[model samples]
Target: MKNMVEIRWHGRGGQGAKTAALLFADSAMSSGKFIQAFPEYGPERMGAPVQSFDRLSDEPITLHCGITSPDIVVILDPTLMATVDTTAGVKDDGVIIINTALSPAQIRKEMGIKGKKIFTIDASGISKSTLGREIPNTPMLGALIKVSKLLDIEKVLDDTKKKLEKKFRTKPELIEGNLKAIKRAYEEVKGE
Candidate 1:
């Protein structure tokens, strides 16, 4: 593990990016690592742009600050590609995880992104095919875990499953489907 792992999340207001960051923080905490997770900006209304951040370290995390140069950038909404610069300020070796069907090469070429390791997953496709929803944050998080080596996939799934249990508990059939989405995403990403 590096000295620290910083993540920048881009998503629309109701896309669960903030929840994803918090869930990732909670999951990393379960791994006994110290972490900081929070959202930037105020009052995110539905369909509006928003950004969230997360930092995880083996040692106790003391710097409770917003992420500037991120080690990993997760794009939760593909539409944001035209609206925001998602790859700006990322570290040279940083990993960018995007929720799109586009290949890494295509994304790099289209976006003209120069630095960092790029990983792309059709998270929306996975979510729609497996969970019947457009929310791909969980699947994307699983891919992030695999690519960035940020957290133990099993631990993340365990913690995230618990956190999401309430919503799917009533529809017991959906639980397994969601888990499958996460696993599928973890397997799909070819990280650099």
Candidate 2:
């Protein structure tokens, strides 16, 4: 696991955290990388806190357990910070990508996070404008890609488009909206 990168996702149920991890795994796999993605749920209800994990590496991954220390953490629901220890187990030099309207510095001050790199994006606003919904997962994925540099943006978008097409067959508009959301978040995320 020398080149391995582990990612932990924090979001609420019905917010597509699981879907985002799956999409990221699919994209990485398409790029010829070894990948694993899975979700851990609490009560399995809307607004319930949920966590998902992803491990990507150039070599095969043998670990089949929970990610205790992740290299990167993606927080789709900023509100979860109030109840969840979102930073728990993250490496000291880890990167944290948060979906919020606040700046990275503001988030760092509010959360009292130090040392680790922090990136922030208004994913909810991006999703609402691009997809006409408040689902922040897809936008968060874009922000993660931008911050992590894990995969090519074009490849992720192409792979994600194919997946979305399968799930939203006749809704070309929905597919395009999601793509737009990803691109917007990719370009709009701010880091410190």
Listed per candidate, the RMSD to the true structure in angstroms reads 1.8, 0.9
What C-alpha lDDT do the candidate models reach, one value each? 0.86, 0.93
Q: Residue-wise lDDT of candidate 1 within 1-192, one digit each (tens)?
A: 457889899999989999889988888899888888999988779999899999989888778667899988999988898879888898898889999898999988888888788889999999999988888888988888888776788877787677668877788767777788888999998544
Model 2 residue 165 distance off true place after TM-score fit, in angstroms: 1.8
Off by over 4 Å in 2: none
| Shift in Å, residue 17, candidate 2 | 0.7
Residue-wise C-alpha lDDT for candidate 2, range 10-123, written one tens digit per residue:
989899999999989989999999999999966688889999999999999999989999999999999999899999988989999999999999999998987888999999
lDDT of 1: 0.86
The positional error of residue 174 in candidate 2, measured at the CA in angstroms, is 0.6
Name the runs in model 1 displaced over 4 angstroms: none
Candidate 2 worst ten-residue window by lDDT: 40-49
